[model samples]
Target: MFEVERHCGPTPRRLRETDLPDLVTLSTAAGWNQIEQDWLRLIRLVPEGCFGVELDGHIVATTTAICYGRDLAWIGMVLTHPAYRRRGLARALMEHALAWLDQQGVEWIGLDATEMGEPLYRSLGFEAEESIERWAAQAPGHIAGEVLPVGFEAELDEQAYGVSRRVLLEHLAAGGSYRIRNVGYALWRPGRLAYALGPCIARTPEAAERLIRACLACRPGENWFWDLLPANVAAVELARHYGFTPRRHLVRMWRPGRAMRPRPRFRNEWIYATAGFEYG
Candidate 1:
């Protein structure tokens, strides 16, 4: 197990599957939108890339890294127990995550930074890329649409994200509905508090709206969450049209010195929402 000593507390170490409950506890305590399944997916996707700080035999802080086939690495789920704040646990885990990604020779590193964490990432040389907004709404009673095959949805996602994320998309599809049309697609799954919609990709604003509406229709009567890129004006308007309101803001940041060919572009106009901040 990887371990790093902190000046103010016990040594931090790599996270294991057994840490899921603790991870969920920490996330819930922080009022974050992650469930045990989400943590498990992170571990299954990048086993050695997650790290945490434990105290009294329980995890008190955490951070995770998701590597996209050595092309791009996303750092997220950075959290610290309320009582552990100001002790540098967040910074320590971040450094460890960065070092591990460096050892793997990842070409690029990125993350969606919360307001409180932006300064730390900036000081570590991460530059701002785009702004992400959290949007929420109540699900409608019903949606009239058809579910598409995973293969089709993956293709649309690849074009909008600028990278193939078949594994991630497949995992999501298995868990929730994959609504698709000739011009767009959307994937949504259950969350602790609401049904989450994301990674929505389309060829036009109208298609994007249709996809989101279809996703909402899949799980009516429940609250829904959508993380959007503000640059997509149509997406923002669509969210509003559907009674979705902005809830939070996150800044997408990236470290330099890595080249991502056809670099992951959101095709903002085509992307109505993201899978989730942690994965993207």
Candidate 2:
């Protein structure tokens, strides 16, 4: 295995496809669910947004920022090799991301922070917003019935996400996606360890359940990951009813720093599931 000194200065740079193997190693080491496609998609989505820090010419730490217009943005994929922890890598990478976002005129930023990472984010001016839960299960299922497709407007999605990111949906729905009669929609995709179902939004619990049931039936007995906000009781109930148990927890944080203006209106009660920690 490659080795490094006890301490190394983090040298920030843009990431490339050639770094795929290293990226996978970092996420796998942390027991994260990202695969090559997930990482590559981000690299392609925002060519200059994926940042990595190298030590002695070897990539050791990384962070990514995606601005969904000037109104809002998200920072994710903050990873550092275990051998290089506590050496100012994460902080440096975070600073780099924030500076870039500021240049893009992004007024609001957010992330799903693990308990281990929460304190660092808080130090950077991110405030707790809500609890994000990852629910999982493996079970066979059959569609309750078919619901005809309907027009899902960008404004409709912004109502739940608080930002318009219609372009992102095309990439996130690569595996398979389904939409119900204007009131609800759900998407499912392949992950490193399992299929992920999420970003589900609906006007009513019944609409949400129908969309969820449709996704569950798509892959019978396969492992699945479902991320949702606990503040939405209907979302919590749907996961439990569909046999998914809580697998992970994260604190959703918004950078309410002095740099930020008043926040947008976010309605999580209508958000049945979040897209992914990386994409959110």
Candidate 3:
């Protein structure tokens, strides 16, 4: 039987290898789903950021902090073993991780909250921004691949990389990180360009909604968005019970720094949990 132990900062155990099975157990126990791929992507892109809590040499809770630079960081993957709840382990691990980022001069820290975690984050100074809403339209019941929606582009083209680069550059230009996770892609023919990430219909609101519907159709359940600011009243209003809510709110508590411009208007229509908060 395992018993609790205190964390030793910056230890080798902090960056141990993790797998989906371990993450699945912890996440399901914690009532968090839909982020397994995000975690998997992070392990590939940046593994050193993943953290775990061990009791009697068994892993229990886990968290990760993705540091973008001296001023930007995102902390996520906060999970605790079901049997270990209410033991202060989650709080302790979070504080340690946030402190480490602070030490690194990460003035801006962000995270998305689960219902159970909202109070904890609120207690720790994470303010309510705006509630997030998810609006999804089921693909045409009888639609065939030959009839892919208009303006529905795939990321599997010669220009795909350049397009992706532009979107990420725009993201960073807006004070957001140039994260490769939120940029959705599709795996088409092995060598052929499969799918595209940024297929925006920036002119009409309905067109924007259709673009999102189109993207969701292309990947089915393979692609998603995370850490988008809740700034769109129309999107929020359209998202009730459609897989969007305050639960989707990308919460943050930073030490204060430079101001960012208002978020992109297009984000109001399409954004799902892609690679967890660490990537955003």
Candidate 4:
């Protein structure tokens, strides 16, 4: 038995590295892949917005909202304890989190939900942006001439804050809001600039164009690839405009059951230059 509650506060002070095992248990129970690094990053970046419902002090249902550049807030990792479902804990946590994000002036919110979660998200006002896509390319020759006209600079070092911030903004343009973690990259090439997105203040389409221009300018003679949310209007349109085509699709899923009722509106917009394939 458990009590469903709404918690809106900073991350619990009692959290320790050892708590990861228990956290993983609940996350797995909810049908999510284990991602330890992501958990740590979320806690550090938005402790107050990360909420959980516990049964007799045992963490059960949980959700996190991570802030991106200017107008985006990414919500993810909505989990519920197996024994604690049918109690509405997931809905409590998610609604509270989204409400908090809305209060913070976040206009664009994003999340990849599991199939089971789709109904809840749709009810909560989260529409499906697109199915996710992925592709791979090798060597400079792979992306020789497919560049966009954004400025290109390599990370000075692994801990370079300047590079990390710029990359974050670029990512916001290409994909959607993304939480920053230690997803390390090659310091040498740092990948070529096939696109140029501006500071966070520009229109999404313009940011995307600059990103593509940057990619073209930097690579000049190679075949670069990008994976975007399947429903991203800008991405699908841009792909057609640039002669790119669909290669694959992925469906998201979650466990427990539906409690949320997010509305389905708004298409996801994607920029280039800083897409996922370039993460490596």
Model 4 lDDT tens row, 83-196: 877677777778787777767766556666666667788787665544665433322333432222333232321122212344333333332221112222211122222221
State the C-alpha lDDT per candidate: 0.80, 0.82, 0.46, 0.47
Candidate 2: 10-residue stretch with minimal lDDT: 144-153
- Candidate 3 on 176-259: residue-level lDDT in tens? 111122233221110011122232322334433433454445445442332334464444443342353343444444334345
**Where is model 2 more than 4 Å wrong at Cα?**
1-8, 141-153, 257-260
* Ranked candidates, highest lDDT first: 2, 1, 4, 3
Model 3's TM-score against the true structure: 0.61
TM-score of each: 0.90, 0.92, 0.61, 0.50
lDDT value for model 2: 0.82
lDDT of 1 by residue, 144-224 (tens): 654555433777777776767787777777555555545777778778888889878888887777667767877777898
Best by TM-score: 2
The C-alpha stretches of model 1 lying farther than 4 A from their native spots are 1-10, 146-152, 179-182, 258-263
Segments of candidate 4 deviating more than 4 angstroms: 3-18, 133-280
Candidate order by TM-score, highest to lowest? Answer: 2, 1, 3, 4
What is candidate 2's lDDT per residue for 25-119, written digit by digit as tens? Answer: 88988888988888988888887889998675567789999888787888999888888777778888998899988888888899999987888
